[model samples]
Target: MAHAKVKRLPVVDHVGMLQGIVSRADLLKVFLRDDDEIAEEVRREVVAYLFAAPVSAVRVDVRNGVVTLTGHARDTSLVPMAARLVRAVEGVVDVEFELMRSEGPAEPMAAPANGGENLSRA
Candidate 1:
């Protein structure tokens, strides 16, 4: 039906019992929502709940079902995770990230008794 561009189809089990009807409009309805609503869901579901990112750590913007995420995350790995979560949100057409990884504490450098220049500093 999808390849044929059929708008509606009936669902049945192996027994051919008419379970329900699926329509393109019904499918689309799941993915359609106001931009602000989508943004809120992304922020609540992805940033805060799924990724455990601070609500302020990531900014979510939705426009025409497209989501834009900007800000920094403590873990770089969360960047992709956040994207995936946002994509799962209903009404999200796409996701873009302008996020930076928050740097952890710097490791202390070993110093030589010779007092040589610290090449690692540069």
Candidate 2:
């Protein structure tokens, strides 16, 4: 009800954050963010955090809201972590990576304590 120029919106907080907005259009607004904006966010939020420039040259590319990470990193084991974080970014529809080991052999990521129920073959 707070939308538009409606002054003094007649809104009620029934459960105090319990009955929050549950609109499908609001949820679908995630895809409205541009690819370039998503790419920059991924580079700053994910790539810069997981793969630094000194050790890794990973490039962030976004197309149609799908983020694609390319290039090799020194710590290939962090691929899973990267994938997880990248998918957490807003406006990310999907994630696709073409990463490889920069030096040594790529090692599998450590299994989670919960048996890696959410883990993928990244």
Candidate 3:
């Protein structure tokens, strides 16, 4: 848009037919996302997938565009991975963690059917 010096851009379909128009303000609106909405995505996408219940419990808090994760994690070392995922979330300007390392070795949610005990982290 800066190179073209256009405040508004037109959207077109496959055949080059006009669909809609997008403005600079429209593209910038993503940063205006609500805090609660951002928190929910962190919980669903990052927390639920990385830290499951019973073994781990994570709390998500969002203010402005920063996200803070608190509570316990089976492997606190995964904080870097979690931060990367959380930063990928839209409207999340930054990510922070206050996770405590969960005691004991990380294990799978369910025992394998093979009848052999194995250690796993997901």
Candidate 4:
């Protein structure tokens, strides 16, 4: 199976699943409230592992304790590998992945114009 990049989906608690209620806005709020620099650092670490594994078909974003991964991998079987990579990172409380299979070449990831540098000292 070809590897594809995946995006992180919103995670729901066991109770929320029973209720069929959970919102993306709520997840976003949780992400935004996280320590910015710490989140970024975790993201970087996750990305490093992903790339080093030779699974370059993915992107990572961290907000609060939630981690979102988006991209394509060469092997479908590598999806769990991606998740495991994020989980191994320190301070990650949740892992969400949104990976899709593609028949075509991978698209270029949008780079933040400012390099997403932290303005405040840690």
Off by over 4 Å in 1: 1-7, 12-18, 50-54, 105-122
**Counted clashes in each candidate structure:** 0, 0, 0, 21
Against the reference, the lDDT scores of all candidates come to 0.69, 0.70, 0.76, 0.53
Q: Which 10-residue span in candidate 3 carries the lowest summed lDDT? A: 113-122
lDDT of 2 by residue, 1-122 (tens): 24563333233486554444445456568999999988987776667656664324788889899998888887877788888877877788999989876886433433344343323323
lDDT of 1 by residue, 1-122 (tens): 68998888999999999999998888888566899988876665566653343558668888899899888766666566666667777777899988787667322322333342321221
Off by over 4 Å in 3: 1-22, 109-122
| Stronger candidate by lDDT (1 vs 3) | 3
TM-score of 1: 0.66
lDDT per residue as tens, model 4, 10-111 = 456777664344455554553454546545664455444333333355666666667777776544455576566556544567788786665554344333
Question: Per-residue lDDT tens digits of candidate 3, residues 26-121?
Answer: 988879999999998777667766675542478899999899998887777778877887887788889888889778776454322332221121
Q: Pick the candidate with the highest lDDT.
A: 3
**RMSD, one per candidate, in order:** 15.0, 8.8, 8.4, 15.5
Rank the models by lDDT, top first. Answer: 3, 2, 1, 4
Error of 4 at 27 (Å): 23
